[model samples]
Target: MSDAEGSNEITTIENPYAYLERDFSSENFKIEVKNLPKFYGMNEFRKLLNEKLKLHSNKIKTTRKNSPYAFVCFRNEEDRENAINVLTNYKWKGYDLQILKAKPAPDPLVKKRKENAEDLHSNKKTKTEEVCSQEEKLKNSTIPYHNVEYDQQLKLKLEDIKKVLKKFGSELSRQNTELKNWIEKQKFLYDGLPCELLDIRFSDTTEGYRNKCEFTVGIDEDTNLPTVGFRIGSYVKGTTAVGPVDNLVHIPESMKVAVKIFQDYVRSSDLKVFDPEHHTGHFRQLMARSAQNQLMLVVGIHPQDLTDDQLSEFKTSIVEYFSVGKGTPAKVTSLYFQKIVKKNHRDDIVPTEHLWGDTHIYETIMGLKFKISPEAFFQINTKGAELLYKAAIELAEPSENATVLDVCCGTGTIGLCFANKCSQVLGIEVIPQAIVDAKENATLNSIENSDFFVGKAEDILGNICFKATGEDVIAVVDPPRAGLQKRAIFQIRKIPKINKVVYVSCNPMAALQNFVDFGRPESKKVHGVPLVPTKAVAVDMFPYTKHCELVICFERWDKISSKQLQSEELVS
Candidate 1:
């Protein structure tokens, strides 16, 4: 039969052995190599397999874009098995290759000739549907531990801190002899620890404890409408879809209501939600902060070529809607408008204009009133913050004769809390606005002993009179999530009066380097006597989430003699 007639006959043939020559058995000769380097040309990859690896391959199949895995086809099963054995866990260009056997690719001609082509198409459809289902699952998985029991979630958080402390202890043991001896001495109080790891503490109320929430304005994948909530993932990964905040357990009901109101307002507005891809449109984000019965709403917009009059009209419409119109039900105490402009760096300051209502929101923690500004950095959980601050203060062990140095003090929350216990409280923050609020907060609470400076802690720590009117200065550092700057760590070490430091870190993994730097041997780059971890505690500031606060107390000790190092006194 001719080729065309043979193809027709194969399509109608019911015999199982029909078209035996087309059975490629490609699966037996193909291997999948994963964990590839992010950037590489196809020719270079082939050369690596052919010349460098001394393994000849017929062809390599890869995605259109740069993928982390690819399939290389050999001529025989022996070569394929050899390739797997050679490349499995093999280090290549700083990455370990994960090699495994791959399934065969269906030949298009065989699929067309087979009468069960519908089955092949059906299988493909099912796989596509499964992929879409997974995307939805990932998009909605904002609160990973929300469904978990509160007790189990707390334990998980505690375990995370324990791991961080354990790794830190190991690093300390390898860094210096004094630190190793110190860890050995402290082993009696806490097992497998460089310091005493205390029981984790948490607030009484765990659910709906968040005081502030920032919601993104973008298209929702589920509803295909404008949404105000969190993004599923990073925008750089092409995931601009915003998931609904209504289902999030950490957000308070007041914040969710505010989100709904703004979402509705944006949907009704003629302008479009700002697209991160094109950087166009008006609405960008909605920030909500609640203090008891009051709620502050800040509307962020991308003014994308809008006229002054148009911007004024847009601002007036939103102010009226939230102030007295349909959004009055939200009882927004403070309303502000901010133009969202893309920044060159993460720390770039963006100003907010008070469109209506109060200029700032107030919160009372530890009986001291704090004035919170829109741009100021405040803890998301209010009740949880009280527990966190309490733990930090306890670890700090403030005394009337000692001064408390509050580094990265936002609005003087921690410093003011320590003012009654310590002789004086000195705070340093980078944000000028937060410093303004900190001074006003001091005045509001009649906290006369505390003084806040407006500059980076590294720049102001040496210049400021931290040693004024005190026998000892305890540095209480509660820096941002990224941890303390190297210069700030250097400055903290240089000060001889700072014998004790209470380091509060929300992200202990990120702050591990800071902790290590404190105990590093004195060098030209790092000066002064080193401090070692003495005690640490975990605070469950964010329940139903993988986040918690870790407070570690670092203290200085005298160097031991070589004779003492050999004696039992070394463990003491």
Candidate 2:
């Protein structure tokens, strides 16, 4: 008798078709079950199917930890079809099972056995292979450190920075100066750290700290519906499937709410979600930024093959829905529609059109009100950015007689922060719009000691460096994750008046070569004397993620070495 037909006392029952040979390798015999609840174990899952639903499967394969999908192999196509019909939309453990016919792939245990067999005859795998294996294990994960504890995550990030610094130290040692000895001594004393490492500073709140989030518009893997969320994996990894952001811990609830409302709006709209592979459809990405309970939503769309009137109607519908319709609950202060078209030429640029509400969002950091445009580069974490800037300023130690040269300054946040402590603040940025915001921010704060300039730092740094009034100049270089360009680094080194540079990097690993360039000996390509790193500290800007802001202090070593010699002589 079937499990459902038999009494509860019959715990074990032999399959009536045990004598019948079956081909489990065929696709008809396999069913993929998605949206598996995390609370259920393998044994519980088997019991739920065999006893609760009276479904029999020859083999069941569960995914690794934290994965939400599994596979079940039945004896025949008839049983597989029955299992799929019974399990689809079946509620268990608070999740409705999304069942689909799964394609045949090598089983995990069988694949492992084959790999082990091959390894017996082959030598040990290379380090690159091992790293690739580890990366493959996390290919399905969006947030790499979501499962790791917060404290342990911070330690891992600190170790990452130390490794980068050690590489920098090794390159610096080749210069064969007194700095080399200093680096060696520091490495010996501090366990591979090039300088004194301070305790990491944490954000005020770790959970839901992100003020800015960019969600993709695509098909969700679990529901197979057009969803607004982050991608499950990168496009390079052959997975463009989007997953809901309700599970991500870094996004603030305000942003999540906006995403939900927008998702509903898009699902009801006639337009289709943008397909990155085909470059078709209308909706592309949704960017939400929140501050003080106010949200700024930028709807990204690929206007492909739509007429002017159709586009206008689409825009009107969105504005009306966000203004008076269902999106009213989101408290959207700024609404923007961005036409996301790829560049056809080198100078081509697509500007975001402001639809309704405010044009800029206001964020108050360190008691200063700064205007953030749709495309402006602002820190994702507000409170954590305050800590990062504080560490940078402390490392800089700008005196009242000093001038702060904020290189690659975004919206003048860093420059204005230093304006109160220094005599003058000259901010240089590449984007003209950001410079406009920066100037307005300087005026908004009502501080006259700061000024913002537009143009690339390499082209404008020399012109702006001589405009400083103070005797001492401190350069604060906070470039993008790609780090400062080679020419920009050369410009900073060429500026003899700038005695100290406080480098704030969100990606220290990518900025390794930039640091090496700064400390390298003077050459034709890299002019001026080399700068030596004195101290460095880390600020935990993004919690539950493998990212942090690194603030490093670089000063003219000739002067520092002279002072050290004088102190040593006095001590002797």
Best by lDDT: 2
Q: In model 2, where do residues sit more than 4 Å from their true spots? A: 1-140, 175-178, 343-349
For model 1 the TM-score comes to 0.75
Task: List ranges where model 1 is wrong by over 4 Å.
Answer: 1-141, 343-349, 559-572
Q: Which residue pairs show collisions in model 1?
A: none
**Deviation in angstroms for 338 in model 1?**
0.8
lDDT of 2 by residue, 441-547 (tens): 99999999988898989899999988999668999999998788777888988888999999999999888878987888777777887788888999999887788
Question: How do the residues 1-572 of candidate 1 rate in per-residue lDDT, one tens digit apiece?
Answer: 89999987755443333323333234447888999998665656887899999887867889854689999988687888888888999987899999989876644333433434455665644332345442344434556786689889888888889899889988877876656766776665587777888899988888788898878898888779998888876543335778787667778888888899888899999999986544567798888899978899989887878999999999899989988899988889999988876632233336888999988888889888888878878888888788888988888888788899899998889989999998899989988878888899999999888888999888889876544577588999999887898778889888888888999999999899889989888888889888888789999888777888999998875533333467766577
Q: What is the number of backbone collisions in each predicted candidate, taken in the order shown?
A: 0, 0
Query: What does the lDDT read for residue 27 in candidate 2?
Result: 35
